[model samples]
Target chain A: MEFVVFIIAGLLAIIGALGLIGFKNPVHSALSLVLSLFAVAVLFLNQDAQFLAAVQVIVYAGAIVVLFLFVIMLLGVDQAEDLSVEPIAGQRPIALAIGAGVLALSVLFISVAADGGATGQQSVTAEKVDSITGTAQSATAALGDNQTDGTETIPNIEQLGRTLFTDYVFAFEVTALLLTIAVVGAVMLARKPKGELAPLPVIPGRSGTTDETEELEDA
Target chain B: MELTSTWYLVLAAILFALGATGLLVRRNPLIMFMCVELMLNAVNLTFVTFGNDLNDLGGEISVFFVLVVAAAEVVIGLAIIVAIMRRRNEATADDLSALRG
Candidate 1:
């Protein structure tokens, strides 16, 4: 059952990503990205990272994509792009080749590493801990047997919350500071001068015959 | 067939590749930004999968940090895009070459 769900979600994610890259219209691409992000959230749920999955949906699909749409509509930049031109010559073929190479290498590494029996993650971690500490029984005991099945048997959200407040609180506060700086910087960069949107300056000497009318208004 | 951690890792790698290809092929700044977001999502999936596979909380915890950084990136990136679009009639990445000065 979980395998079926993973396959469906993975397909949805890949298809949505393809649409995102292939679509000429910015709005269509943005919508495609939303679909892809949502599918990823489903994959996260399947993996039992419940808090991260919910955060993925709320923050990514909810806030970030909405911001994309808001900027798109606000700037009125939804016009279809010209797909005919390659602004940077020879960029396309090289990029595709590199991308393909990367994909092939990654797939090869993963398959080769998993060639041994699928003993699952718990035993692997336990073995590493045992080797480092030179105590197999105690290391396995420390890691606990609850997760031997690879399904999140513990309440992940509770464990995550505890970890955040206890072990990772400083990093969490730093992230908050970074967000505040981003907000301030964005506002500063996007703000226009008081009269920036007013008419362009008309100088008679610099103006051509076509702009004579506007120059007269300036005088 | 039974799904394994390797399967998830492979899926993420493919998605990341697609995103990189899109980033290189696409000229529109907005679309390029979308590609970057796609790549980030792929990385997030990798982190979560590794975390789950290890039965460790560290992987998902790192994902939380990644999400925060991604959010900040989106906020700043879109603002930059909007500012550039306001100055020019079109928002293609090629047009911004004046900044190559």
Candidate 2:
């Protein structure tokens, strides 16, 4: 049953991602992206990364995509019109070749990795514990002693929070600072000036003479 | 072959490729933004898969940060897009080449 859920979530994510690219309308694309992000969060939940899943929903699906929609609406840039002339003449071939190359490389990597049988159930659990604790030695030791069954043990949220707050505190604080800066910058950029100001006169010394000369000439 | 988590990951990869292709091929800024989001979600899927495989909570925490950053990006990105549209009167990415050297 759990495996079925994972399959469904993965399918949803893939479909949503495809829709994001397939749709021409920005709103539709954003909606598709939202769906994809949500599906990913579900996948995280299935992985027993409950905190991550919740954050994924709250941040990516809820805030980020909504911001994209807001921008689209504000700009009124979603009109169905082709903005650029097709084939700027020189760049299309290069772009296509590069894209194809990337795709080929990705496929090759995936195939090679898959052939190595890297998807066994045991290694994943061990990797997860090591990542969370930031020490492979302890986790490996624990795994050696606790080898009761083949089923992987899922770590609890409390352990996760403790690890994050303790070992990764500085990184978390830095992230917070970065977020604060982003918020401030966004607000400043979004705010419009009340009105345009007159241009300041250049050549301060000549300004008065030039104005007097102009008046005398007109008289 | 039997259906496994790896199969799901492969599907995610295919989806990611589709999204990347769309971004590369499409000229629409909105569509491009959506495609970028699709790619980000694909990465998220990989994180979750690895997380599940390892049975650890760190993946979840990282995903949380990704989500938060994504949200902040959307808000600011939209504002900038709107500003650009108001100035240009057209939202097509072709007109956004003012900075192109």
Candidate 3:
């Protein structure tokens, strides 16, 4: 079951990613990205990171991609980009070569990695592994008792919440502050510049800034 | 065929590579931003895979922070893009050399 699920989800993810880059239209790319995000969320479930899977769908597919579409529409720049217009000769080939090199190096590193390459102390959430009960035996561990027989391990969300609120609580508080700052920054950035407007800079290829300058000056 | 953490790590690597290439090759600023989101998602997958392998909640918790930061980044980035595009109807990444100091 794990193999089957992994193969399907991984394939979908790859297809979505390819489509994201292959599509000429930004909207189609955004939609393909949604498909990829959903596939990744499925992968999260396979790894028992259920909480992340939910957030992956809700925040990424639901919120972030939607925001992308929103911006594309609002800007009215949804027209198809001219992919063949490569002002720099051979830039695509160089970029593709670099990407392939990165993939080859990472794969070589992982295939050589001992025990799946994850190294570090598995602390906080599952501190002690009780040999008898075959489950975590930590004080702060948030193991869920969904099954009366105690066969149920720690639920992913509960443990994540516990860890977030405890050992990494300060960092958690800081994330809240970061979000607030981001909101304020966005509002400031999107707002139009007011009063005594310097004339818009002259674009190299485009002609006519007088009309726009007069319009801004009037505002 | 065993579905190991290595599978996920490999998948993430491919995703990251694709995103990097797309960001590099695509002149459209919007598409480049989407590529950035793709890379972020790839990292999140790697983080979850590691968390599962290590049998720790820290990995999952770190993913939460990543999601929050990604959200904030996208917000600010899109706002800047909107601001820039408002000045001109169409502007590609190459055209955005205003910070050429």
Best by lDDT: 3
Distance from true location, Cα of A93 in model 3, Å: 0.4
Q: What is the interface RMSD of each candidate, in Å?
A: 5.1, 7.5, 3.6
Mind giving the per-residue lDDT tens digits that candidate 1 earns over A1-219? 989999999999999899998998889999999999999999999999888888999999999989998988898889888787776789889989988988999888888777753656557774574456442233233446543644555567766776677677889899999999999999987887356553434222322345555544664
Clash pairs detected, candidate 2:
A52-B60, A64-B71, A71-B78, A124-B53, A124-B54, A125-B54
Tens-place lDDT per residue, model 2, B1-101, is: 35555665775676677677777777777777777777777777776675655655455556656655765676566656655555446545655644332
Candidate 3 yields a Cα-based lDDT of: 0.82
- List DockQ for all candidates: 0.59, 0.41, 0.62
lDDT of 2 at A93: 57
**Cα distance off (Å), candidate 1, residue A196:** 9.0
Task: Using TM-score as the measure, name the better of candidate 2 and candidate 3.
Answer: 3
Name the top TM-score candidate. Answer: 3
Model 2 scores a TM of: 0.75
Clashing pairs in 1: none
Q: What is the lDDT of residue A17 in candidate 2?
A: 71
Q: After superposition, how far is residue A153 of candidate 3 from its true place, in Å?
A: 8.9
User: Which of 1 and 2 is the better model by DockQ?
Assistant: 1
**Which candidate gets the maximum DockQ versus the true structure?**
3
